[model samples]
Target: MKKNALLDAAEALLSEQGTQALTLTAVADRAGVSKGGLLYHFPTKEALVKGLVARVIEEFDALVAEHEDGAPGSYSRAYVEATFEILTGEARAHRRWSAIMAAATDPELAAPLNEAMTRWHGRAPDEDPDPVTGVIVRLAAEGLWEVLSHTPELYGTARLDALKQRLLALTRG
Candidate 1:
């Protein structure tokens, strides 16, 4: 529980202030725990980062599993569903996601991020679209996510609804 709390605090800080703003003391302070307690769980920032990466992967896997109903090639659909859920869910906005992404500029982080995406983009987890089309669609979706993350209010409800409908139709086709 303490560990999870620390991770949650770290995630919040990462989202709000990026990795450059992240520090062991900040995490400890944000989590409302002692430094010793935080250290007992993570021991180091790198370890905490690895933990965060693992949690993101695990969360992604669970989201896919929950929404895809065990079907193959369900990644796009799962992604759409999960994203909608994220946008609508009661949880805080995922600012940390952008921060963690920035942190991936480090060689160490780059490897894990690449590995995670490669594993997820393989046959079983994602759908088998035409390879070229899939690449295009995925890139486009990522761009859309960045836009949404950075300037969410720029998209009003109707626009978001329309984009969702169009993307869903395209993914289905």
Candidate 2:
């Protein structure tokens, strides 16, 4: 739909040009829609940003769900699987990084993302009986995500796979 197009345009602008270039006018132009059309979907830049954040969170949740099984530590395992996928997938990497940067710059914009993460992390303790191990695995996965976001070349594919496999193994225990 047109709303998705506008969101895609906004994400493209954010990823390609950075935050300063992500105005409503720029997004409207990029989507090949008129200003009124853009306004019909998203009235303000903040609303657009929230839409982007929500989309990313929804996509990530679906990815995690795909990895989930009816077992202990499933959420932790899914988190690791989903995080690794995002880190390695090119388009996903760009979209995720753009959303993260936008959220980092504005506290109000960060609320949705922060809340989603809090909900996920809260489930970790309940999903994995061994709370400490779950926390450790989650932290390790998150730490790698943060590091790679800055310096993607920090680890080669083989090493990254090894790390991912190790984390997944921990989830079984």
Candidate 3:
């Protein structure tokens, strides 16, 4: 819980000011914890970044699982729905993820994120969908991510929600 609190603080700071404004001291200050207490949980900034990456991967995994456990066509449908949520400000947690992704140009942060993505994507599929279709859909989603990560107003939540619905319909067809 303490760790999550710290991550939450870090995410807010990162979103507001980017990696330049992030520091263990700042996280401690924002989280209302002592520097020593913060250090006790994460001995270094690198550790905290690693924890943040893990938190992102875990959250994404949870979202995937929630959709995967239900009815047919859930994977593609959930992917679109969950992504719409992320891009539409329905899931504010993505701001932190965008920050982390931006920070990842620095090796200290990038490595863990790379590893996490690798593991997540490398996982075996139960019944893999068409590879080409999957790739195209994922690329479209990536395009949406690019838009969301850069200009928050690039697309409104309603438009994105409708777009996702259309894409999911197409994917189902």
Candidate 4:
């Protein structure tokens, strides 16, 4: 519970105040926990980063799984569904992805981020026979997300929604 609180605080800081505010002290203060308390769960900033990355992976897996049930023989749709879920999910969901992906710039973080994405490439735990379209869906979604996060003026809401709907249809095959 304490650990999760720290992670949530970190995400909030990252989203609200930018990466510079994601210090241990800031996170501790945000969580209403002692600095020592934060350190007990995450010994260092790197450890805290790892926790955040883990949260990202965990959340992504659940998003994918949530869309898996009704997709019949293909998980391709699930990939798009998961993307849409993230894009349209609560602000924290979108912010979490942006924060983790941005944090992945550190050399130490690259492996874990890549590993999580690679695992995603392997498809959900249940094993979806068709995995190719998933990669495409992820690519398109990430591209759209990159724009939406950094340059909202590039795409209007209707256009974004229309594009997502079209992408979903394409991935259906």
In model 4, what lDDT does residue 45 have? Answer: 86
Rate residue 71 of model 3 by lDDT: 48
lDDT of each residue in 1-173, candidate 2, tens digit only: 37778888888888778889899999999999899999998998888888889988998899999999969989899999999998888655667677877777799898889998898777838678688899999899888977876677889999999999999899888
lDDT of each structure? 0.67, 0.85, 0.69, 0.71
Best candidate per TM-score, number? 2
Question: What is candidate 3's lDDT per residue for 1-173, written digit by digit as tens?
Answer: 38888888888888778877789999999999999999999998888887887777677667677777454445656666656656665545355465465458678677766776566445434333554564456557757776677577766667877778776775553
Cα-lDDT of candidate 1: 0.67
The deviation in Å at residue 124 for candidate 1 is 7.5
For model 2, the local distance difference test gives 0.85
Point out where model 4 deviates above 4 Å.
Answer: 70-73, 92-94, 97-102, 122-134, 151-160
lDDT of 1 by residue, 38-105 (tens): 99989988888877777766766687678775443356767666666665454423633643564575
Ranking by lDDT: 2, 4, 3, 1
Per lDDT, the best of the predicted structures is: 2
| RMSD to the hidden true structure, all candidates | 3.0, 2.3, 3.0, 3.7
lDDT of model 1, residue 135: 52
Q: How close is every model to the real structure, measured as TM-score?
A: 0.79, 0.85, 0.80, 0.76
